[model samples]
Target: MPTLDPTQLETLVVIAEEGTFDAAARRLHITPSAVSQRIRALERAAGQVLVRRTTPCTPTEAGEPLIRQGRQLRLLLAEAAATLKTGDTDDTVVDLSVVVNADTLATWFRPVLDEVATWDRTALRITVEDQGYSADALRRGEVLAAVTSEPKPVQGCTVEPLGRLRYTPGATPALVERYRKGRGIDWSAMPMIVYNEKDHLQDEVLAAHRATRPPVVHRVPSSHDFHEAIRRGLGWGMLLDAQAEADLASRTTIPLPGAKPIDIQLFWQRWRLDSIALDDLSEAVRRAARSGLRPTRPL
Candidate 1:
């Protein structure tokens, strides 16, 4: 069995976090040559190239497991040190990295910020990713936890259903009238707005209507902007149920006729670590989800 050096593993973790050999060296207070030596020695032990030589260095497929291991080890060490410290003012701050979808951030995930704000000794790092793709961040060990649409947990992680985020196809009243085809709006002729290429809600609506995408498909990546685009008549797009209902009551936007609501089931996935920070975060997330999201029914 080949022995992996703790120092080398930590060096690789720093490199992965810093995104460059020089940056990692600066963080570690070591020379770039020294950083290179540690990585080279690690790769030799593993018999596989670990870090990809890119502008923002990334871990190769073979390196992902090691990166995760290194992070876990570092987390444990930090916790242990904090526990062992005898001082009344132990200043060990645990870095907690989490990924959340933009829509959730704009909606139900706000309370999480409030909860985290009270934790003086925890450093929070948040990555905005689409719920459907957030699991990729977890798989790569880029985040400790994620609010993801994927029901299955990543290896070494635990998953629990958070609930479903409901979306309704909506458009400005003027836009809908302009594209009205007799009794129903012309799905093929109307311009559409999508969150991004990864967004499929608009496509799902179109598929339901048996229509192809219109020539003018505007991509508004931001959740708030996407909702505003629909409101300002840029193009029709799906809006969160809360957003749509408010607009509907205000007579700013109307739900698309014959379009059914889209419900995306969300799950909370976190590394299976025996850490109080992670557990507290998970509880907070669950509470927020319960308050803001619709309960998911058994399939």
Candidate 2:
């Protein structure tokens, strides 16, 4: 069996996190030459070029296993420290990294953070991205867990159904009057707002409306801003149920009649580790999802 030096593994993890040799050295409080030497020694042990010399350094295929192992080891060490230092004043914080979607982050994910506050010995680092893409971060070992649309577990991870987020097609009354004046839509003249280039909710809505292409589009990447853009009559977009509450009640944004909401099924994927902190975080998230999102059939 090939043995790894813990110091060298730590060096690799730092380099991958920092994204540059000099940055890794500064983070580790070591000389850049020392960082380079350790990485080279690791490569010699692995018998492959682990990291690519790209701008903002990326891990090669061979490096991924080492990176994942290093992160898991760190999680175990933190859990062990918390176990040994069991005292009221024990300031040992378990650092957790997780990936979540922007929409959920804007909605139910907030409540999960509130739940975490009750567990004073844990600290979180969250990455917000699209639901369809968050699992990629987990697969790359950038995060230990993720809330994603993907049901398939990332190789070493376990996955379970959370719930579903429903999006309704919404528009300001003025825009609705402008484009949907009569029996049919003036599709070519109506501009639409989207979360980003990756957002397909608008397209799905348009297709259901029997239009092939969007007339015009305004991209608002932030969830709150995206809702605001629609409310301000910049363009109509799909709004989450919670986000559209005030507007729907006030009739400021009218729902597109007969349009079915796009239901996005969400799943929780996490490394199958025995750490209590990770298990607690998952339970909190699951509870929030159950209360907030529409129930879906179990996978």
The lDDT leader among the candidates is 1
Model 2, which residues run further than 4 Å from truth?
Answer: 86-92
Off by over 4 Å in 1: 86-89
Best by TM-score: 1
Per-candidate TM equals 0.96, 0.94
- Count steric clashes of candidate 2: 0
Residues 226-287, model 1: lDDT tens digits: 88899999989988986677798897998888898899999999999998888999999999
Taken over the whole model, the C-alpha lDDT of each candidate is: 0.91, 0.87
Native-to-model Cα distance after best TM-score fit, residue 49 in candidate 2, in Å: 1.2
Span of 10 residues, lowest total lDDT, candidate 2: 180-189
1-299 per-residue lDDT for model 2 (tens digits): 47988889888988899999999999999999999999999999999999998989989999988898888888888788888886753877787899998889989888898988887678899998889999998877888899999989999999999999988888888888887747656655689887877888788877776776565788899999999998999987898998898889999998875567789999999998888889999999999998899999665
Q: In candidate 1, how many Å is residue 69 off?
A: 1.0
User: RMSDs, each prediction?
Assistant: 1.6, 2.2
